[model samples]
Target: GRALGEDYEVRAAATAEEGLAAVEADPEAVDLVLLDIRMPGRDGFWLLDRLREGFPNLPVVMVTAYGDTETAIEAMKRGAYDYLVKPFDVAHVRALIEAARKQRALTRSAVSLEPDAPSPGDRIIGNSPAMVEVYKRIGQIAATTLPCLITGETGTGKELVARALVQYGPRAEKPFLVVDCAAIPKDLLESELFGYEEGAFTGARKGGKLGKFELAHGGTLFLDEIAEIPLALQSKLLRVLQDGTFQRVGGTEEIRADVRVIAATCADLEARVAAGAFRADLFYRINVGRIHLPPLRERRGDIPALVRYFVQKHGAAVGRPVTGVSEDLLRALQARPWPGNVRELENEIRRLLASTRGEVLAAEIPPACPGEDAACGELRSLAARALEEGGEGAFHRFVARAEASLIAEALERTGGNVSAAARLLGITRLTLRKKAEEYGIRVPDPDA
Candidate 1:
């Protein structure tokens, strides 16, 4: 308590029963709990359950001896906020307390979908018909432990839906862990998910580490970019989903973890299966409870609400507190095709807030395509002339010319950055490069 300084008021309890009683008596007064696992009478686990039942939002950090880190980890899987090993650094404890406080606050805030509602923290913030359908699906399956698969275009809030599932489910009190399969290298992903025994391979730790599966036992595990999981690893994942059992890499013992798995992907798994890149059976297993999120372009009616939410959220964040958005600004936002969806809209809001000077946000809306304002007139004239000439391949030729022009403009806008241009053009970098080459357009070296 002294180590945490005068900023925190510490309350100590002699026994597990006494601690639970104190919290039950005045739950609102307590922000954090540090319980020793070996407390006399009823044990920490018993007290942990009592605490969870009463105050699922409260953060509890388990205290353990040097060799009991595994038990501490087990405690975390079973709803403890974190653990402190004996003789732990005072600074580390302080950091853990701070983090737990922040997370607890966020969990308690909950996600709100009220249109144009001002929130000081995180909220879902959409009320269009498509978004309403999305919410309905979330409400329907969030309470069940069904294996859920969230499919959407990138930046369409797939992870947000996944978190909502964890928040509303019976395992809300337990740990919620996320793994991005695409971010991890393919070679290491197997061991990353399943763990490995000591001496399993070169440079293995003396005490084999626990994998996310074991760590997330009795809770939720969110696997983003699910389609990126390699074919060989798919079978192992299928086994766990089938029987809730898996062995550590290179280990004989079969370990079991009761985890609710939620997966998200932007890729079309049906195409992957057709191409023989993904297993058909595995796809069907995860597809049992699927939720597809509509892209932002399909739900432009929700743009005002989204813009309002982002303005309030990012305005204070950027230290430029604008009173409100202009009608002109809102219309301009709704006019563009947000290829990157909500994520892109939020980024643009942040960019505007960084340089915004006035009380009301009003800025020039750039053309969707660079130089589009200047070229639209000429393009219309060309189209009319092509129609008058009535050539057999005129339509195809016009489309090719327009596509080439857009590709060149996107590249120019991004200063020859192929990846950025591809994102702007709503196509893959590979496709952009092929089109650029076919059109005899030169792009700067990627390394440059």
Candidate 2:
């Protein structure tokens, strides 16, 4: 109390009832609460439910004893701002408080889909016909608890679509959790989704932990890169989807959670299932409602609006607000084949915002290599010629010639500057130099 009292007002309550009384007497008296999980009379969770129901905006941080981290995690799932294990230092508490305050403010704001709204909310900005279909699909399903599968190439804003689904849904006020299947290690993925019991495994936290399904009760859980989940764990996921019941990693008691599952992936699940890499049953279960987002290249008409939206969004964040982008820049942007989709385009715009000095952005957009169709056609022609002339090693010879040609072209365009050339080619300077040397392509001095 002494440590925090020096920095904060520091209200004190001995028991859960007292804490409730403290808040009930005057809710405005407290901005945050530090509640312990093992309190007398009414437990922290019971009180937490009251706080969340009575004052949904109030941020609460769970204070748990050492070895009770899992319970703390469960409290977090129940809308606690954060948790702190006993024996934490003063610095940790302060840092958590600051973070929680910032996040609380951020979460309360609504997300907007308005194309040209002045507010800092329109995270999704597009009016293309394809995108209109996406919006329509979201509107149709967002109000239900149907399990949804979002499919799109990477950076096509799958997560944003998932967020839109949540924001427009009946569970808008509930917790929304995200798990990136590709990002987490395969061995750890199961535990992350379902959590584990204390002593479930060596080095596991003391108290049994609640998984996403349990934590996200009455909310939404988004699984990104859904195809990456291991084949072994697919059944457990399917069980939850079918019955809304799953057990913790080391515990046997079945836990049921009212969580809506929304999954996203860039990979083809049908192909994965055919290859025995994914479960067909699970695939069908989650694919009940599907939304496919088109790649940025396919939605070229939306490029100008996206560009303007990104400029405004990033400019304000970086304190380099621009008046507008030039028509020539928009034309150039629309012409490029953004292999990385919306994310890549936003990055290009951010780069321009950083480099441009004028209020109106008129910087020359770098020329793109080629549209997908044209590039594929060019490759087909090259391969046919190679097959006819190069005979036995046609594939290898064609690849070598293509690499050498691209490297030589990039070097020439960049005036033999290896780093600049490498950036243009989307490769490391060292790799470019090695390839250039192997191909006997002339490059100026490394420094020059």
Candidate 3:
């Protein structure tokens, strides 16, 4: 049970003392520690505090018999990566381990958050000149407290650039908050950015609420989709930027704001300004330290690295282990035009990892059919076949023949490994077996 299926190097400690000793002997030996709360001598909470102070970046998973909402919240605040109740399954523990490892890996990566990185974009994965320029720009911006504007196509990772500025900059030690101007309702956005006094508006919380600007007083506020901010609210935003001061929604006292703003937009703010939708002055102010991210298609060399990262990241977390990815799969990934950019690629890998039952293959990836839905490729082929050989029930014969051929091919290639074949055909193993029986298909045994 402790082996975590052989992929992880599990270290056992009968007691908290032994665990602490193991950690102390080689402080960096453990990537994740699963400490039980009911251990003899000092409890897990005490050990948690010690480990947190000693290795601040270490991911810890706390297991406890006394699970509750308050306990869970407290454990999280104490820097526990995740918590498992007494009766939790081993699968849950494995998932938590994956999450922890991914978290730790992201923390150590130099590109976005690594302070004192040796070279420009040292942590970023790509060596493309465009990416290299972005890295250099990020380093330059990180040296000062200038308001930065990051512009890119949707899903090009604008937030990542914003994060790099904060993590490698003077504001590294302070809180960094984000507000999506497009996601939140415009009517409530002002109050959300700036606090509102009690009874100032209906549905307002008791006492008052501290806004993102006030909460991020000594840190950074990342405003995503800056172009979406309503024209009426832009004046207030301008005033805040102008003198670093703003009042509550219904109050007269001006709150002296002292927060740095990093704005991002996928839209052309200059076009918006010219169209009289966005404030020109605010656009220019935030545009001081600018960084534009290239779409994934323009950075094709980075695709392989990103795919590996996502596969490892999601496979571990979701418990769908893939031994390796086929070269054919890599080629399929590289050839596509990712309209959704890096975010799309990450989601695709994650979805593939979650669905695959064994080694990932080229057949598992969605085919790149131009001007047609990948899901309907088979249907399109069948339709064309029906047109080629027209007769009564020709469509029915085509569907049945195609289905039988697909099932036969999948079983043949997998050596009758039902689960693997099922994954390849994107169906359940039981469904495949039933279909084989219905079609009287002869599936060969592995040792035949």
Candidate 4:
């Protein structure tokens, strides 16, 4: 304890039983533990296994003179913070303890403050019934290796869901490789994924490059915009999924990857399959489990929590001390439909922090998007009429129809190009498409 620094407080336990007692008595009192693998009566492995069930967060550093690679790997698998070969340097032990403390601090900070609400790290932020269901589904599926297909609008945090699954699941320590199918060039994506040998293609790196599958072995491989992957490559990806075997672009030697595939897309994949733009077989392979992130407008109840999260995150990033958001500003925020979802909200917060000074955030509030403001106004008008008309369903249908018609007309004017229509309507393409589909309106063809 004294060797490290005055900042650390250490307690030594004589026996495994006593150590377990001490830990159970006051879980928060201990920071790092030096557990000997060969202890009297109950061995270190047994103790380690028991401690994991009760205090998984506690950092246990194993100490053994007869340690082997298998023992080290097993300790890690059993959640040992780190292992020390016996007669190890005092400084090394101190360093490992310090690192464990830092990791624990980060984990604690990620939990949300509100006791009743789900913590930020628990799942995606939202309180709607749909969101609650999503969280439940995530918990149920996190333990399995089944492929998950995340479907949502562009800014609806599909990647966030994927990351959360990896972070909170069994393969948390393993690699989490992301392949942006839409961003990478079609010609080079295959090589990037399956890797290439020195002579596989022109300008190939010497030796052989490890593909994403190899890099993400025994972990997750997230394929974002999976629908954008070229049809020819889809067959290759399918073969890997079927046999977990693939050869480098130029090499004939087969390599097996034990990876969990999580694919995501913003496109209507079923429609794309019908159009022959995507492989129907690949779709079925990756769709064993699915999670659809609802667009922000559909779950406006989450706006407050999301806004607070972004404000705090960006405020710290920009070195500003931000006070709580104003009630009027929050009302305005909740009133506006966030087309870009969590991502757009984060960007807006960064912009606010960059432009404004002082603790109060009202001064940094940007003008509401024109479409959102208009929608809010119409809702208010409808609400007033509904109050007067004794809450008639006809009025509700009328408002819904009007909103749908307005969106459909805007999409039509843009020639069914969802992105262009989103730009024209001052909304996100994800939000626009969702609204269009909800209203049963035909999405215009870009060619037309």
Residue 247 in candidate 4 has what lDDT? Answer: 85
Please identify model 3 stretches exceeding 4 Å from their true place: 1-124, 318-320, 360-363, 372-448
List, residue by residue over 301-391, the lDDT tens digit for candidate 1: 8788777777877777766557778898899999877766777788788888877789788876666865454245346433543353454
Tens-digit lDDT string for candidate 4 (307-421) = 7777765566667577667777677777666655666666676787777667766753666645565356445433443343343465655465456546755655665677877
On lDDT, who's better, 3 or 4?
Answer: 3
Every model: Cα RMSD to truth = 19.0, 21.8, 25.3, 15.5
User: Residue pairs in steric clash, candidate 1?
Assistant: none
- Worst 10-residue lDDT window for candidate 2 reads 106-115
Model 3 vs. true fold: TM = 0.56
CA-lDDT, candidates in order? 0.76, 0.77, 0.74, 0.72
Q: lDDT per residue, candidate 3, 29-136, as tens digits?
A: 688898898887888888899998877667788988888998899898887767899888877677566656544544446223221223333234554546655665
List, residue by residue over 1-448, the lDDT tens digit for candidate 2.
Answer: 8998888888889899899899999875576788888877888999999988877666788887855657866886787766778878998788666545433332333223233457545566676557655665675577678999999876788999899889777899999999987556678999999999999999899887778888899999999978767767889999999998999998899889899999998767775564344688999999999999998888898887787778767777557558788998888888887767787788788888888988888899877654566456446444543564533777776696578657766766676677898999999998997986665454566555
Instruction: Write down the TM-score of every candidate.
Output: 0.58, 0.58, 0.56, 0.58
**Candidate 2 ranges with C-alpha deviation above 4 Å:** 1-117, 370-448
Q: Where is model 4 more than 4 Å wrong at Cα?
A: 1-111, 114-123, 364-448
